[model samples]
Target: PRPTQQTQTFIPNTSGGNLPEITSELLNSYIHSSQWHFIKQLAPKITPSLITSALLDLHKNPDLAFQFINHLGFRRIRDIKTRCIAIAVISGLSTSKPTLQLLKETLNSGIATIQVVFNELAVARDELRIRSSTVFDFLLRVCCELKRDDDAFKCFYMMKEKGFVPKIESCNDMLSMFVKLNRPYKAWVLYAEMFRMRIKSSVCTFNIMINLLCKEGKLQKAKDFLGFMESLGIKPNIVTYNTIVHGYCLSGRIEGARLVLNAMKSRGVQPDSYTYGSFVSGMCKEGRLEEASRMLEQMKENGLVPTAVTYNTLIDGYCNKGNLEMAFSFRDEMVKQGIMPTASTYNLLIHELLMERKMVEADDMLKEMGEKGIVPDSITYNILINGYCRCGNAKKAFSLHDEMIHKGMLPDIVMFNALIDGHCTNGNIERAFSLLKEMDRMKVHPDEVTYNTLMHGRCRQGKVEEARRLLDQMKRRGIKPDHISFNPTRLTYNALIQGLCKNQEGDLAEELLREMVSKGITPDDNTYFSLIEGIASVDKAAESSNS
Candidate 1:
């Protein structure tokens, strides 16, 4: 016999002598002997409260408890209360893989739906519903773990609909999942439903909602929710402070983030590395490198270990400031602290080195990175290709492109754009066109920049007619060309008109002049200068030939 406490207030049948108490010793003995039929026979008489009490006692005897939980897989049990208890215990078990697999097979067999199980719980009785909510909560987690999101969500909604209040922790898990899936709107809706149902929320619940608000870019709403938390007597933790701080930082509101840091300190909450990292990242983008460096030092002085992301942010700041020596020193400091540099760290360094036109040093650094087991991604290859293009080495750029392809990296639009722009700048219209064809075959849609470069290259090679057709093709593809694409500068108009006139296509030049006029741009003296001079020079050459 178990000494019963008054923990289960809604327990039935005891005061009225309707249900009899079954001894824990007898239950344990039956389970230990593997008397499955006898266990099933006694399951109906077990009240939900008795089930709850027995669970607390079962942990004392490991072997009996193991067999007891395994015996819960029986499908013939008719009592809703006992079935809920059995499934709940199985759901909460930390078992081996085989046990879990068997549990999964058993669970998927008899239950038509999670709601059907919930509906059978007799929730109108307060004590039974209170006892049953745990099982439903555990089942919801099981559904979530199995990636049965639709069923999990339905089960949760049913909890609210059936007048059964869900546990705060289970609600938080569901909310966290919605946020992870980037479906914050659904989380917000569920939270609203939770409020309407009078389900009590904990501090963690508030923090989860705050993070969702921040992630959705509702910064002001997030702050208002923080105020609401204080009003409701829910003291914000460091996680709450960190989430709002990061939100402000993401929006480039550096001053707002700094104010949050001050407020957190005044409230006696110590900011961790993550809190400082957000402010540092924001300051770096605003070009306030000195303050960002000072914050980094402050984080160290506070005895909080900075993350690799922290060092990477500072490194990027120095690199963008054209302070290569400082950036290298930070990289060294990171290594000394036993924080290995990530791919982002090297990418920023290599990009800046290439921009400074230090080709030999850049190549050596890339080779060194590879030797150190850092595989370069597509972004690294694109930067190197763009560097080669800028240095008028289209051949080297093409070789890098081929190497990236050999490494199984599908070239992105930026990669294709760099190569196309390189060939165009080299006046190799044929190669540029071939690359454009490759882009089409790869299903990478060309943006406005692609067509602008190709048109300019065609015009440079006296293929003004081809350039005009490419512009039309851009429109047919539903791409709205910028001024540089179709309505180019007066210089581009001059180049195209000069090329057409030089080719002895005087009629084509007149058509181009009329077309340029239709684009709402005023033709200046320079535009006519190329057209008039080219025609005059061509006529003079024709007269000389006749003589």
Candidate 2:
């Protein structure tokens, strides 16, 4: 709260009206007064020049200026000059929050670009004789928080060019934003820049860089980072160790993870749920379910409560191994342990149930989800939509599709492929084609699965020419069938060859074989069988024509 207004004698202006001349002293008096309504009454007389003068007058008392600006409201400070002056004044206060708030408001106000604000703030800073670069540092922090990484990067160098080094926290924020955006390369460049600038890094900075190294699959380098930190006399924290453990686990190097675990413990850094969870997940990935379960037991014995992620990892393992009994047992155990199942937990169970062709059970599980207040996410809807499609009930699949969209979930490529496959299976080639057009309108690029399904549909309808055109279109679009590693290119060639053979287009089928071989796609037994059938059909047609 501002101090009460001091009783001061005011001298009337010779050319002014009944109100006294509004000098900086009078403005300061009104600013410190508990009666802000008086200032509101004098709003008409307040101009940008008056605000700038008053800010300069109250430069030594930034708190009063901040309050005065707040009472003036951002709308009144619409001009870029006044706003920057206001930001510069408030920046002198001991707390950064008020200054940051004002700066953010100024930038978001659209009165000036970031560059303009940067320049104006510098001018205002110089006019006030404020030598500190705190205001510019706050600008970088705000830009980073707004996710304007490129703009922030430009501003960073700009500040540096002006002989100003932003505080280390601002630099870390920039690096962290790059990591969050998955632009590890940019993060590295910026990291090197920070090093060159001699900006000392914090533990948070090292942690973020370690995560980046792990993301790039440079696990060995990630481990070496701990040594680098130690050499610099910086102690490693729990997060640092957990990141490396997780990295090793992600690459299926369980032994490497074990070494890290032992090292962390020997250093008196105890393993938490996340640390143990990584091991469980890695073991599950390697099909060591029994070992993963035993690890879970050890985690519990250590008095570390397992997170939903831990339980979910175990459940997913069992689901993959087709052991629903064990999966459900873990789910029940988690609920009994007072850890409510997350949407992810339910999604896993529902996906496995659908994979087993048990639609009724999947539906029941979905109902249970609503009862338990577990809102279904996009993954949940995709699982249900796909299950219904596989069961040949396109109506239910489409109905679920509408529901998911209504719930504000955008259907991804996987869901679209399922819908297209469902339509093709039901002999609705025209509808499938329409969906393909919809994909284009929605800016969802159709992948090879999309073209493969469409080609197979056209072949089923005996529209061999359309299927062949689809193959050509696939080539034109540069859609690689094996872009998704699990989907082999052979499946694509097989679909086209079988379609041509069925339509008695043996010449086209043979041509496709040659093309497939030229692309280094070895023809499978199905490919040869389709070619032989095509040849036999062509021979029969020729004989019949001769007779």
Query: In terms of TM-score, which candidate is strongest?
Result: 2
TM values, all candidates = 0.72, 0.85
- Return the top candidate by lDDT: 2
What lDDT tens digits, residue by residue, belong to model 1 across residues 293-322?
899899999998889898888889888888
Q: Model 2, poorest ten-residue lDDT window? A: 1-10
lDDT for predicted candidate 2 compared with the true structure: 0.86
Model 2 lDDT per residue over 1-547, tens place: 1122322222212343355356556666777674577666666556566677778788998888887877767655667777888899899888999888877777676778888999988889888999899899999999987888888988898998999987889988998899889888889999998899999988888999999999899999998998898789888899999999999999999999999999999989999999999999999999999999999999999999999999999999999999999999999999999999999999999999989988889999999999988899999999899988988889999999989888888888999999999999998889999989988877778888898899889888888788878877777666454333222378888988998888788888889899889988999999999989888988999999999
Against the correct fold, how does model 1 do in TM-score? 0.72
Residue 197's lDDT within candidate 2 is 91
RMSD values, in order shown: 10.0, 6.1
